[model samples]
Target: MNDQHIVKSYDRDLEAIQATILKMGGLVEDAILLGSEALTARDIEAAERVRKGDKAIDALEEQINEEVARTIALRAPVSRDLRILLSVLRLAASLERIGDYAKNMAKRVTVLADTRGIEGADASLRRMAREVQGMLRDTLDAFVRRDAELAREVLARDESVDQMYNALFREILTFMLEDPRTITPAMHLHFIAKNLERMGDLVTNMAEQVIYFVTGEKPQEDRPKGDRTAYMGAP
Candidate 1:
């Protein structure tokens, strides 16, 4: 009876940790969407709100790490339980990075607000951000369901995000080359696009962690990357 009670207690602790992670994921999703919307609308107040909300996301991550550490110390979880806790750390890290990228995107809205608008560039970036946000939503779902197949599906979708980034990169480059006046805003838009692309990559990493947690093996195939703008020193 005592052992059963202990097991149940550990399970409860794990559930709490998972709950915190989901909460953090929710904040990250909001950041991504809100940041993009603010950029598209050129709403400085909305962008500032997105930036401010990042503190909550960061707080949740810190809370999760502390909870995980406590659980590990008290429960001494082994095998699959240990794997789940470790994967939670990785997922939290990825989510935090995605949040930071969203903040970075929001930070640029003010700078671009003053520069001459690049035709359709903001709209294109919003679409790209939307794609990444969708992927992150599905990745979180996969993590909760412990659905490796769903996670793998999310992994496959990242290539589409990369392709979107590639297209945006070329479009922005064309604008920069055609009008010297567009160089400043176009460059900021490109940075925003790159941030979105990196967010996609981070979402994929989270999806991969989900797959690993479920299957006990990482996917053997190389992740398909569609971003081809690296030749011009684009990071």
Candidate 2:
């Protein structure tokens, strides 16, 4: 009876943690959508809104921190449970960092829109944003669903975002090289692309973390090692 009760208690705690993670996931999705809108629409106000939304993400992190601390105080979490909770803490921090990158994208939006005038994103940029946003959405969904295969799928698709960013970078590079008139706006676009690339890298981190959560071990090294950019997703 005691064992059954303990198991039920642990299960309930896990569910609570999952719920908190999903709430944070929603915040990240909104940040991505709002950031993309700000850039595409050249809406400084939208950018500011994303910036404000980051505060809510911060608050969520704090809430999780407090809750986890309380859980620790009330119950003696075993090593495995400790790992799960700690992994979650790290994962949530990465997501929060991703939120900041989105805000950085928003700032770039304000700068570029002010310089270039708010018409809308070019066809190419819109396509890029759509691709990246899709990846972001899928990665978050995989986490919520605890689908390791889906997380790996997110990892495989990162090259798509990279290719899109490179292609767009080249396009803007030509703009910068051919005409000095394009320098300011082109730089703005360059930073935004860089930010998106960084954001994709962030998703990759979350995917790797998901893999750890499921397997309790790191994936085999197929790619080259010591790639700091691969792991440096957040503050």
Candidate 3:
């Protein structure tokens, strides 16, 4: 009713939205950890839990979208406030996609568990997944702290994830060539590696959003990429 009351109401709405974002982020982070654990341990039950947990992440994304829209219509936020809401929307979308990648990784576990395990492949993938999970955590922290430098650090880490995938790609290729029997499992392993690489990229996207939110400008430097599987193909 009064101007003071309106300001307090808007503040409450913004806080609520941020709290939801963190809640959703926590779920995604857990999914990443659990999904990678399932893969490395060859635990089908853990993988199933990751798959079922995705439904909650999806619901949170929808809720964030609705709340953001409602906030915009009711409060008519301006300037930095609007920027934050917009950033939250983008962050939610990125987190949702990361969740999907995690879910996809879990889906492959069933097949991988049934087939013979590729030597060292799950270990490499789990390591990559762990790195991505760390990046995601840092990006969320950056968002909360409004730390552009930390977000940039998260972006820089993406190259390591790509390099890990490249290394695994060559290893799998060699395995396939060395033994015909390994081709099926190697292909599945490659897919999981690709999925983890993608999750890293999505985390980088989230980091970029944090940078933009803090500075109001996207980073000018080109993101370095190390994925080289395409070049290794038969010519």
Candidate 4:
């Protein structure tokens, strides 16, 4: 009876940690959307709000780490249980980095606000951000469901996000080359696009972590990357 009670307590503790992860994921999703929206709308106030909201995301990550540490110390979890806790740490770290990228996107909105607007650039960026946000949402779902297939699906979708970034990079470059006056804003837009692309990569990493925990091994296949900006000599 005592052993059963102890097992129940450990399960409750794990549940609480998972709940915190879900909460953090929700905040990250919001940050990605709001950051892109703020850029598109030229809403400095909204951008500031996104920036300030990152503190909460950061706090949740720290909370998760502490909770995981405490659970590990007290439970001495081994095997699958230990893997779950370690994966939680990796997931939290990835989410925190994504939040920082969102914040970086927000930080540039004000700078671009004053620069001459490039035609359709902001709208394109918003679409890219939305794609990344969707991937993140599904990745979180896969994590919660412990669905390795769903996680693999998320991995496959990352290539689309990279393609979007590649298209945006070319478009922004064309604008910069055509009009010297538009160069400043176009650079800022490129940076934001890069941030979104990086976020996609981070989401892919999280999905791989999910697959690792679920399957007891990383995916056997190499991840497909569609971003070609590096080869194109893009800054």
Local distance difference test scores for all models: 0.90, 0.74, 0.90, 0.92
Scanning candidate 4 in windows of ten residues, the lowest lDDT window is 218-227
Count: clashes, candidate 2: 0
User: Where does the lowest 10-residue lDDT sum fall in candidate 2?
Assistant: 226-235
lDDT per residue as tens, model 4, 181-201: 999999899999999999999
TM-score for each candidate, following the candidate numbering: 0.96, 0.85, 0.95, 0.96
Which numbered prediction scores highest in lDDT against the true structure?
A: 4
Pick the winner on lDDT between candidates 3 and 4.
4
Give the alpha carbon lDDT tens digit for every residue of 1-235 in model 2. 5978977887787779778877887888788778887777778898899999999988888878877777766667887777777777877887788888888878787667657531233555666566766776776677667778888897887787777776666667666677778888887777777777777777777778787777676754574322233443322
For residues 1-235, write the lDDT of model 3, one tens digit per residue: 9999998999899889989999999999999999999988888999999999999999999999999999999999899889989999999999999999999989888888878777888889989989999999999999989999999999889999999999899888888888888998888889989988988988888898889979998755666566777778841
Candidate 4: pairs in clash? none
In model 4, which runs have C-alpha deviations exceeding 4 angstroms?
233-235
Model 1: residue 75 alpha-carbon error in angstroms: 0.2
Residue 95 error, candidate 1, Å:
0.6
lDDT of 2: 0.74
138 in model 4: Cα distance from truth in Å?
A: 0.9
1 against 3, candidate with superior TM-score? 1
